[model samples]
Target: MEITSKLLNSANAIIEAKIDAKSIENKLNDIAKITAKKVKIDGFRPGNVPVKIVLDRYKDDLLKDAKQELFKKAIDDGLKDIDKKTDEILGEPIFSKFDEKDGNIDAQIEISFRPAVDVSGYEEVIPEYSTPRVTKKEIEEKINELLKMIAPLEKIEKDVLESGDFAKFDFEGFVDGEAFEGGKAENYILEIGSKQFIPGFEDGMIGLKVGEEKDIKVKFPADYQAPNLADKDAVFKVKLHEIQAKNIAEKLDEETLKKLVPNEEDITIEKFEERIKTQIKEDKFQKLLNEDLKPKFVDAIVEKINFDLPNVIVEQEIDLQFRNAWDSFSKEDMEKFRADKDALTNKREEYRSDAQKSVKLTFIIDELAKVRKIEVSDNEILQTVYFEAYRYGIDPKKHLEDYKNQGILPAVKMALIEEKLFNDIFKKDKKEEKGE
Candidate 1:
């Protein structure tokens, strides 16, 4: 095979190879010999099929397999001939010109390589965010939230049902003078003004006294989950049995503190409050990192750094993002993409910018990691995998296997490494600010 290569850009190239007819003939015959052992023709014994018959009978099948093999071999030999490693290749090679052309097995393959980028200005592209502060008010709010979670309902005998009150009742709903399925309940507790029930069902309970019998008219929303009830007006014959209000916990008493921190030994009210504050701060920090800080940092880096991106990598990122989003689309939504061709075309163009940004960021992160001599440790990867498994209630070993099978093990490590890189930068910046 005669091989030659041309650099299209910093991160992409075209490798052209030409094969002699004799080589093709030789490989074809060798494949035919192997095929002979697997064939059992009506007139021939097993492993005794004639070579000519095998070639004639399965020429197309044999040639397809031979072509793939030749392409792979050509790629390996051609890469070595040009001094490139398989590890440096980003994605699969595209056979741009593969056919019997110009009296040779002429093929032109397009390949994407990991882009070489100088991320010197990456440290300057820091995300602007303050570590979320837990205030006394926030702690009080959290305490109130806990109060809501554990609050008991107390029966009311005198005061009329008011908004934010829970009312216990028995009701039979009627649509067009007929009771419907799932429209009747006995001793159902409905929250007034909470909108837990259908439209007007909760609001209609307001201003009612205990033992009061009233008819609440409500309409099910047009886009209701149950198709049968959609946009239907119904009358509920409600007989209020009792009015109940939340008895919120305002003081962290001995028993309440124990209940709040059941697993903590020798815990006090101050300790409980401190623990709650710490938990809230941790939750907010993680949320801020994921939702705001990370994206801002990535965006800032992408804006400041410039590099030639592999077109194939960008295209693959676009396709992957499109597929992941498409998986969530409803049948009707998917039909819209098919019916409105312009919508899909416009959508692809819209995703193009994000795809390019994602690709560029990937290359930038890799370059940063290399320049900084940063490495992701096996223990870190194991911790991340185990944390994910614990979150999703899956076996960590099986989840790790699944990640490997899906070709995302490297991606997982990259994600952790990227996070660690940013965190280290933050730490350095903080220390510098403190003149440490």
Candidate 2:
């Protein structure tokens, strides 16, 4: 057996190995010997099976297991020869070349690795962004939005329906004087100006009187999802049964206060508004970081520090981004992308900058995490899981196992870590700016 290491680049290395086929065969024979003791054959005893028979029946399986063992051993030997450890390897060893000759086999495998990064003044170079301003108007709008969410319905005595009013009505559609399927509903509650109905249907209901029956004509969009309704003109006979309106309170009631905050007491308007303001700041801070600051920060850090990136990691990033966006494409569009190599390459190239940014950021954050001794806690993970489950209307207790199985738990943990690190950096930068 012979093995040699070659540095293809700073971030990539290749390990070439030449192994005699006789050695592999010997290993296969040993594996066969072990299998013979556990074998079951019609003509053989419980603990006895012919080696030749075992080899004949399981040569491929034995060779596969032998190859795995040999591959691991080869990696260990290569690392020892290079004075490196497994931790230096970024991703798995990619099989670059494999061929078998008469009595020996030659193979080359590639490894992507972390390159040294000089981030001495990353704090000074990375961009800082201002938190989004929370205006009084926005606060009022948000409060109104929340009020709408929990507003009570009240019957109105008004005879005429107007914009922003709710109407309960029965509607049936007809095309060419013939009723169409899925075009009728009884006692449907609809808000005017909501546009929940087809174009001109809800607008046509404006100024309609309760107990009045009328026909609304509408033309379905040419690009409508339903083939049968596309580009078709239809009429709906609407009979308004009731006029309803939403009523919101002037002040937060006791029950409403508890509903607003399930786990809080002594909740006042001032306290609630302050809480909402804090929440708004947190939400805007995250959005601001993700959309504006994060990219600029990454670019600045990258510009300040130069390092080689592994092609394999970049390629993986391109593939991952493409797959993440795969669902947005039509089958025809996806096929075109696959069929046209130039187009696909161009598309991949567009993401090259972003991929490099992400890969480099991962390395920088990893080292910082180690140096700072930053760690994610189990309690934090559980809190994130329960919060996410609650936000998505999943019962945390019931879907705890599901989250674990779906790999959501680890992802949440990583996300929390990233959020925590960036937020700390933001605060530190702000303090330095203030000469603190």
TM-score, candidate 2, is 0.79
Candidate 2 regions with alpha-carbon error over 4 angstroms: 8-11, 114-118, 128-151, 171-186, 196-201, 215-237, 248-265, 310-312, 325-351, 369-374, 382-409, 428-436
Estimate TM-scores for all models.
0.77, 0.79
Worst 10 residues of 2 by lDDT: 427-436
Clash number for candidate 1: 0
Q: In candidate 1, what residue range of length 10 has the lowest lDDT sum?
A: 427-436
Model 2, 1-436: lDDT tens digits are 7888877777887788888888888878888899999999889997789999999998899999887777777887887777777888876688879998985779998887888866676779667455456777777777777877788888989979998999999999998899988999999999999888778999989989999999999999898888988999999999999999988866565777677777877788778887787678678878878788877886787677778887677778777787787788798878988899998777768777788877777778766666656789999888877887899899988778887788668667767777777776664434443542
Give per-residue lDDT, candidate 2, residue 375: 81
Query: How big is the positional error of residue 189 in model 1, measured in Å on the Cα after superposition?
Result: 3.3
lDDT by residue for model 1 (1-436), tens = 7878877887888888888877777788899999999998899999999999999899999987877777778878767766778898988787778778654688899888888798886767787566667789888888878877787888866568888888899999998999988888888887788777887888888888888899989998999988988999989999999888878787667787677668978988788788888788777877877788778887788888887898778878898889878877788878889999998877777788889988898888888878877889888898899899999899999999998899888888999879877666554334333542
